[model samples]
Target: MVELLDNQRTFHIQVKHTSLVLHVLPTGHVTVIYWGKRLESKSLAYVIQDIGRASYISDTDGIKDFKLEQLPQAMPTHGNSDLRTPALVLEYADGSRITNLRYKDFKVYSGKERLPGMPTITSGEEVETVEILLEDYLQQVTVKLIFSAFYEYNAITQSVVVTNLSKSNVTIEKVVSSNIDFLDAAYDVCYLSGAWGRETHRQVRPLSQGAFLLDSKRGASGHGQNPFLALADKQANENSGSIYSMNMVYSGNFQAIAEVDMHQNTRMQMGINPFDFAWQLVPQESFYTPETVLIYSDQGYNQLSAIYHRFYRECLMKSSHAEKVRPVLINNWEATYFDFDKRKLLSLAKEAADCGIELFVLDDGWFGKRSDTTTSLGDWQPNHQKLGGSLSGLIEEIGQLGLQFGLWVEPEMVSPDSELYRAHPDWIIQVAGRDPQLARHQYVLDLANPAVQNYLITELSTLLEKENIAYIKWDMNRNITDSGSSYLAVAQQKELSHRYILGLYHVLEILTEQFPEVLFESCAGGGGRYDPGMLYYMPQTWTSDDTDAIERLPIQSGTSLIYPPISMGCHVSAVPNHQVGRITSMDTRGIVAMQGNLGYELDLTQLSTEEKLLVKEQVVQYKEIREIVQLGQLIRLTEIENQNQYAWLYRSKDATAFVVSFVQVLARANTVPKRLKLAGLDAKAYYQVGERICTGSELMSIGLKLDKPIEDYAGQRWLVKKIEK
Candidate 1:
């Protein structure tokens, strides 16, 4: 709920267990007074009065108030006598760079409103909002700060809408989505950072007296950095203490910064990066920033993550497959690679269907003159030479076997040898006088160009219309380099990266809206672009290119910190794993992969009859518990480290069913059984486990013991169902 204490000049917004209090000072500048646990409606006027003395220091001129530098500003501005990191920076037509804003007005509403061209929380009666307006009288600019409070989630969504009200145009250098301040620096910053094939590794460091930045400028939410940051108290853990998190719902050039001022005050800001960025704001033109989610959890990191998971699962993902159980799919990428023919693919599909797999995805070899990585990337048509029949006929054959068909395409890449690229060499991103750099034997198409984007849309739409494709594995195998667009002017050339992301989002929006039934799984060389922005279009993303079970434990663990399980695409590949060459038990692989959208990557036709039976059983078991695994609350029972064990627990939303998956990493000479205490259960109810029944209290207090002297790489999965008295 959102309330305005007009008498005290304070705005109070509460959502579930969290509250945010903002006060308007006598100078009309807004500052955050308190943001943490839920608080009663009370006046904070005295708090403002205490800092009133600093408003006018004897050393400063009578016209300037030094207090603006001390107050915890809601949106700090540049050239306002405050030296902090400004949330709004602008350059005017007259060469003046001053921006001083004050509270103009505010409006309270019943439901949340969506931000244009961006992902945001869904609107409902349970959600409330307050939009506060701030204006710069000298520049004739208006800024609207929007806050949304969700009743079920301990989160407040924030965004900014900046409108130019002057007669001429203005240049916007930087405008952040949200800026928040804490009274003191008593927290540690936690973020996710890593490289390709080893993405989203968790890193935590203490907040010192300087600025710490977590950002991505690789034209995508690159594998090197993720757009998430959290500030947890020094004493915070998984279950206790105060935690503040801000995540940007954008895919391109983004920044998240935590700055500690001289007064020991800390300010956290997140939005689009200002480097190489300048937006032209014409008169009456409004620029809308992407929404940033702020979650306050007095209970700790797990509580903070739970709020994000619930919000994304219900609000961001818009496809029809968002709430449904995904099919147990088998992809032929690792199995056949670029060597599959019509007979080979049909054999694989037939075997996969017999093993109860619902879908078969033909990856990387079905289109163009493409048999290898060096050719035919831009061509989207089917290769009749390899298929030996019409594409629709093959799809019909697969459907006749009671299996769905999926195809893979790299729509944003073009090979130098391909027909499309040969015809239109200027379509790719490159400087006019330089040789375009190549990665993965391909050049990235300049999606920022309208012609290039339109061509791709036409090709993809034609294919989707011609065939009965149920799923699409959209892949982008290369990063952007030599970032210069031929269509943009010299001054606007620096806008290529951001414009590229906008173009990609535009294509996805139109395609997903037209074919809402098709399940789209995004892959940027596997998890490179696995972010909230992509999840808004595709419900799930391939977790990583490295499908090795042992390596995946840490990757999935760190990814789960910010993203939900339903958004991760995990696959069980062959032992002697293609990526890492590590041989792990198939059971261990299946158990690990089941924690995500479960699927298979290896050749099922090559398995022995007994192994095939195991595959069938795994498929059946996954079907029985798919709903709980996809929509349940996930609890990490064991920390992911270089230890002998890793475990996870999934509990139904209603607390009636739960499943625990445990894996023994390696064998030991002489070891005792490890006991794990489970969480999120009905303490008084009895649960049936296999043939035995135990009270939830016993499981929570006494714990469950693992099998002693377990074999290396052994895995166990246990299911418990609640029993009524």
Candidate 2:
């Protein structure tokens, strides 16, 4: 609900258990009065604070106790007596950067409105939006701060729209999507950081009296730094204390920053990276920033994550199958890398079908003259000779084996040695007179070009239209290096990073809509571009190329901090694992992979008879709990920081069924069995697990004991069903 007190000039936006209050002072400066647990009282004017200014502190317009630096502003401008970081920075045609913005007007709406040409939350009846317009009357610039409150999820989506209302052009140096200031710096900052093979490792540190940054300048949302930033009370745990988080709904070069002022007040902001970024807003032109999700929870990290999970599933994802069960398939990437014939794939598909797998994904090497990662990325045509017949014929044979077909394609990359690049060398992103750098023997396609967008949409649509393709593994194995675009002018060159993302989203929007039944799983060399923006187009993403079960413990846990299990594509690969070279038990691998959208990435035909039987049994078990696991409320049982053991629980929407995944990373000798406490269970009801009956209260408080033989990389899964009266 959004309430505006006309007499007090205060706006209160409430969602579920949270409330965000803003007040416009007599001087027309808007400030955040309060943001935290909901306030049920009708009067909120008393919440606004004016801590008298210090001796040397600068005040605004000679008004005593009215300093901009000390106030929590809604949108602060630079060089206006505010020494803090500004959310919006603009340079006018006169080369002047100073401007003072004051509250102009506001509008309260019933539903969330989409940001033009940007990925954002879907509009729904349960959501309310408020737009606050602030204008620099001197410079004739307008800034619209949009806030959408998701009523059921306790999430508020924020974005900014900047317009050049002046007669001359305005160059935007930095435009942050969202910013919030806290009264005290008494929290630990948590962010996800890692490299390619070990992506999304949770990192936590206490917020000090300086600026901290988490950024991605790799063109993609890079594997090194994910776009999630959080602040939790120093003593906060899984089930208690306050936690505030912000996640960007963008998959591009981005920045998330936390700054502590001299007064010990912490400010958090997130948006597209201002580094090497400058957007020229012509007269009457407007630029829209991507959405940033802001959530607050005094109930702890679990509650904060739950809000993001539910919000993404319902509001961000545009796929028709967002809430549906994803297919339990087997991707052939690890099984056959770049070497597979029609007969070879058929044999594998036959074995997979016999093992009860529902889908057979033919990964890489099936297109162009591509035998390896070095060639034929943009050439989407099926290698008819290598496949022994038409692509549709091979798919038909695989379908005859009782499995659906999925294909792998890298639409955003072009191999230098391929037909596509040879015919149009300028299609790649490169600057004139500069040698283009290559990664994985390929160049990033110039997606900012209209011709490139049309070509990808046409090629991908043709393939999807040809056969019974049930899924697509969209892969981008390389990050962009030569960031210049041949189609864009030199003045607009810096806009390439954001424009390319817009182009990618444009193509995905069309293709996914045309093939709504086909599930699209995005991959950027594995978890590189895994942000809410990609989830807006594809329902799931390949969690990581590192499929080693033991190595995945922290990766999956950190990813679950903001994303749901249904959004992670996890698979059991061959042992010794292709990436880590660590041999783990098949049971352990299956249990780890089953925590997400389960799949197999190993050669099924090569498994021994005993191993094949184990795969079959695992497939059957996954099917029994697939719906509950995919559509459930995930409650992380243990923090991944523990390193030794990490566990999580998934409770069904109705709370009648629960699926728990517990993994022990390292084996300890002569140690007692560990007891794990669970969450999201009905305390009054009894749950039955393999003939053992216990009340939910007993299971949660007393905990479940892991008495099995403990070994390195050992994992376990349990399903608890409610006992109906």
How close is each model in CA RMSD to the real structure? 2.1, 1.3
TM-score, predicted candidate 1 vs. hidden true structure? 0.96
Model 2, poorest ten-residue lDDT window? 47-56
Estimate, for each residue in 293-387, the C-alpha lDDT of model 2 and write its tens digit. 99998988888878888889988899988999988998888898888898889999999999999999998899889997788989999999999
Candidate 1 lDDT over 271-326, as tens digits, reads: 99887788888899998888888888887767776888888888778877888889
Question: For model 1, what is the error of residue 624's alpha carbon versus the real structure, in angstroms, after optimal superposition?
Answer: 1.1
Clashes of each: 0, 0
Error of 1 at 157 (Å): 1.1
Error of 1 at 633 (Å): 1.2
The lDDT values for all models are: 0.86, 0.89
> Candidate 1: which stretches are off by over 4 Å?
6-8, 51-66, 640-644
Looking at model 2, how many pairs of residues clash? 0
The pairs that clash in candidate 2 are none
lDDT of 1: 0.86
